[model samples]
Target: MIPGMFDYFAPSTLEEATRLLEQHGPDAKLLAGGHSLIPLMKLRLAAPRVLVDLNGVAGLAGIEERDGHLRIGAMTRHAQLEASELISDRYPLIADAAAVIADPLVRNRGTIGGSLAHADPAGDLASVMTALRAELVVVGPRRERTIPIDDFLVGLFTTALEPNEVLSEVRVPSPNGGSGGAYVKLERKVGDFATVAIAVQLTVRDGTCDEAGIALTSVGPTNLRARQAEDSLRGGSLDEQSLRAAADLAAQEAQPAADLRGSEEYKRDMVRVLTLRALRRALERATR
Candidate 1:
């Protein structure tokens, strides 16, 4: 299907891009890697009057550590994250999510900002970032602001970003000593969207869980931060009993609907099983 007609503008600066969006208002859209938008446009589900291409925008494509967090530029490609030594060494959860986001073609062309902004419930990074409690930075005309990942994702296909704003970066807290995380996904095949996916990060000190983050994907309107599950693990030993209790809470927290993937009950059970597996894996990594 051919996309509807639209004017295209390649802005070399983010300010200019935002200015174009401000001028064009709701009729304009920002073009990142175009993996998600282009398909919608082709199907005539979206037809913007103008496209502000962000590829030419400078200073929006890098991964680096600053202060106490890892700053990931909005335009950074999934393949870049998967291949990054910094992510591999310290943020293995990010590496795991990056590696499973579709095939190489999609990974090479898709941008992290685009994925998060699209806000698909099944998006891998959504669950991973939620578990990390990442922050999102957005730039608008003459201003910038940061939003927590939890607040940034408002609903399915919706975000806190204004139409005239550009998501500029993602900031994840640097893992401390004794901290580790894991991403566990269940899919029918390679490159398939997850039926049920779980992301877990744990910080253990002296054999006791000091902190924990548990998040789920493809189970609700948005990536769910399993707060109940996280709370269950804090200050507890990372033993089979505690892990089982937390897993049960996570399963209860999931809101999977019956679909071709499986019955709702089946997905909820998978959540319990995966949560247990991920917690153990995170604990092992944290203790090592």
Candidate 2:
């Protein structure tokens, strides 16, 4: 089905976009890549009165390094991220996740800011952001604020963003020495959302784990941080026994729902399997 009739406003500046949003309030929606919003609109799940397009807005589509963090403009396309030398060198996990989102056509059009703003629980990029402990920079009528990844996702298809707020950029810390990350997902087919996915980042020192971040998607109402599992790995060697124990803890922590993708039990089991695999791969890379 086609989306319902709506007024379009292409704002060349953020001030103009914010004014449009303030004018329309809840009746206005910001259009980025439109990969997520357009589908929802076509399905009649979202029917805004006006679309404030941000494509014409300058200075919202680049990747840069600032203050020890990788700052990505909200309008940066997935395809751009996939080809970014800085991203591949400093944040390979993000490049891996971006490369797997849908296909070439979708990646060429989908924007990182749009994906995070949409806050789909099963999205691979969301899980990676959670594992990387990224921060989101948002601009609203009143002022600009930063929200951590842990606090950004509120629930399925929900976020901390207020109706009039817009995401401007995402800030991810560059991986330090002895740090490595990986993302693993099990999908029924190419371009499908994960049935169960795991993203792991580990920092090691002298063969012992210093810090670990584990995040799971498509297994809960929101992207889940496996805090218990991460704590289990800290201060321990990345051995077979420790890895298995952490994987078990992660699987137990998952609160997956029974859905068409798979049964809750099946998803929980896959989480165990994927967690172990991701951890092993991350550890190997860190050591190398």
lDDT of each: 0.95, 0.91
Q: Mind giving the per-residue lDDT tens digits that candidate 1 earns over 1-288?
A: 899999999999988999999999999999999999999999999999899998999999999999999999999999999999999999988998899999999999999999999999999998999999999999999799999999999998999999999999999999879999999999999999999999999999888899999999999999999999999999988889999999999999999989999999999999999999999888888988
| TM-score against truth, every candidate | 0.99, 0.97
Q: List the residue pairs that clash in candidate 2.
A: none
Measured with C-alpha atoms, the lDDT of residue 86 in candidate 2 is: 86
Model 2 Cα lDDT, one tens digit per residue, 1-288: 899999999999887888889989999999999999999999999999899999999999999998989899999999999999988777777887888888889999999999998888888888898888999999988899999999999998899999888899999887779988888889889888889989998889998999898999889888899999999999989999999999999999999999899898999999999999999988887888
Clashes of each: 0, 0
lDDT of 2: 0.91
TM-score of 1: 0.99
